[model samples]
Target: MRDFPSRRRGWWARQTPRRRVFFLALGTLTVLIAVGVGAGVGVQRRKDNGPAYLVDPTTPSGPPPDAYPPNPSPNGTVWQPQANSTWQIVLGSPITIASTATSTVPDVDMFDIDLFGNSASTIATLHKLNKKVICYFSAGSYEPKRPDSGDFKKSDMGKELAGWPGEYWLDVRSSNVRDIMLKRLQLAQRKGCDGVDPDNMDGYANDNGLSLTSDDSIAFMTYLSSAATSLSLAIGLKNSLDIIPEVVNMTHFAVNEQCVQYNECKTYTPYLDADKPIFHIEYPSNSPQLSAGDVSNSCNTRVDPVSYGAGGGTGTLSTLLKKMNLDGWVQYCDGKSSTTPTES
Candidate 1:
């Protein structure tokens, strides 16, 4: 996850402001890796914790939690998180979550997407089909391409994001960072997302440079979840298996990637115990855009060939046989397929 965020930052940062805002807004679930983190490692600190908040998973927003956190969310969107829902996570470039195709991917649940990449009209399209929408965001780390990058203070940053060139780590402790995130959530409401997916929330799992502890991530998630709930926006946990037991109650679903490949799917089963969906993905085809052979072997549970392109091919299909961009094109176990790209 850290690698995905670290490497891709350069690709994102160098883009024009419009494109940068668009990509980061999409909340592409990139961990610190090659393409997204092109800049040096970035680490930032937290301050005074965060605003206090509260929500009833079964109830839409009403009031903010008393004490600690500030009043209302950044934008005052009221949302509630829930369960047994289905989902898809594709944050890479160009994945279209806002298509007008009346048809669905066929099966399971809801759709999670880049908050920026998806538009208000796209959300309306999904609602027409009775599906809930989850907006994605980076609750951790600093991406050079984000609209709020300039909002981050050098004093609040630390480390080189390693493989990423244009990016660096962010101090989660910064008041500036929290404020920016609050604004992003507000936009989710303006865009009409039912829930929110904040990626890279696990600072405890990487070379984050902030000397960030699991406790730090836990506190942060608690803060974010509570705030999201207050806005009536359902909230979820993205791939922080270590803290699931502690934060599960705060989240409505578990958004995960590569859980099958890492042999760690069991860690998220608790979400199932809680009757929540663990949105799982494995790069069976190296990239989502699988070569026929790659798709055949990987999908069949045959041997994993080293030559099989890893991340690139998986991006195209692993989620819905659509690319990392999450376009409407999708294929399933029965060899079914479809394509529908969203238009803003």
Candidate 2:
């Protein structure tokens, strides 16, 4: 299994044969596979978990006074995933969210993607298909390879992201930072995304070296919310459990990484209670022990239990064990797997 990560690394290295295609795949946490174990499962909006968060903007008062896009949609307001909204997130690379992904799970809701990697036409394609698009960008950390990486001032950078080498903590407080982020939002708008998913906002919880405060994070989120609003796009507060109450109103949805694993799903309820969707992802405990029963959830399944086992895992994961490239490979919590690949 030691050779597995290296083997996967080779895949990306070879991907640049035509053009240097840097990839950012989610790291597999082999340790957590056993966590979910025999926990009984089913797709749910979390029943009466003590009145979830107030996420719905159109309260009994009838949609907040905030200005929204002029709706010309035949269906009225654009697509926003509610409790039962089916969704998928793949940041590893560009995905044909509209024609390809939508064509397959056209019935599902919401497709969160890397904002920088995807092109404007790609986003336009999704909008043409009448699908809600979520543009993803690293809010706290700055990847050195991004198109606008050079735009980030060295003074704005802090320390190397503890584990990620080419990345570093960003001073979310700087006006320069705001400018770069605003540019990203503008890109999202030009691309036609329905929303934005600014990741790594939980810098306050990490050794960001930026001395970032919860208030700072909140302020940054507020800025992002305002930017999204200007573009008529919804924005999500990505995995900052501590500030949920503070920033909940500013953002439209919540994109949680591992709520159950972190025992913080409750903190995310505020968004859910408000009728927003909590896009979740859990890792497989054992890379090699994938059972046929793992299909219960969209995540927490084995790659090839027979060859990999309960712990030994390999290959690029798609969506749900989808693929390293995040194609159509889906591994549900029940261990059921399928790769409905689109034409490359």
Candidate 3:
């Protein structure tokens, strides 16, 4: 065998240089192909397990160390909405209001629309009509369709929000996440929004895989409230009923949904006591064609002890009856309904 190896070496030394070079190149390519296949298998294994970020708890998992300061004096520069203020929220699509139009359909004190869907001119038009504008955005969730969605790192996301596709619960403690929200608040400021309706602030109350707690939500709200105040924008506490007592003083109002259906309307009476408006919404089964029962259930739901007494009187709830999609169609407690025109 030793003699055979020596003979093979001698034969290779005598071969043409081109042939030797070709064999060496072929050997390198074979090794490279093997390595590539092994790497691909490793990646596939990781994918099968889950995203690498999900497995690695590299980011901080709990509320930040610095506790949100005690609720400071109310910012007089920001809008302080009163209790029982009239409003309409059209988040299904952008409302269409012409510059020459005299007034918006279903004229209310304020209009809540999607922050990214509407333009500065639309806000200006609403301003000309003497109506306040509340820009809406998701603060505690990762929405893939948002313009800044790509800014979110995989490490900052957790479980997908139930019943909402392509929307995931965000790690509220992530500094990167808070930075993106600050930018969103800046956008609202530039767009002339009188207030902001930051939705999905109750991630801790859901099955968020990030182990978020009420403290985390409270800290996140503190950050949001501070940022919005600095930008001279009013912020609303959206559906975070568990943390309402902690954050209601910092927020300007409450943008609640389905509180009546969930029998949690009483939880929001704090806003009423603080003279803050509860911009409540209830999604009935047949909206725009609401039955008397639907109207009664939504518009007549008792929220407080005094106004909504045993007689089922209209309370401080800035109530609106609409479809689940939250389109322009709005029905009031007085059995009046109107559809605000929207852009296709």
For all candidates in order, the CA lDDT equals 0.63, 0.65, 0.85
RMSD (Å) per prediction: 27.1, 31.8, 15.9
Listed in order, each prediction's TM-score against the native is 0.64, 0.65, 0.75
TM-score of 1: 0.64
lDDT of 1 at 12: 56
**All candidates in order of TM-score, best leading:** 3, 2, 1
Of 1 and 2, the candidate ranking higher by lDDT: 2
**How many pairs of residues in model 2 come into backbone collision?**
32
Misplaced by over 4 Å in model 2 are 1-79, 97-102, 105-107, 287-289, 292-328, 333-337, 340-344
Compared to the true structure, candidate 2 yields what TM-score?
0.65
The TM-score measured for candidate 3 stands at 0.75
State the lDDT of candidate 2 residue by residue for 7-114, as single tens digits.
777855656544542233222333344444422221121232212222233343333334444333233343455654656666765765444444634334567778
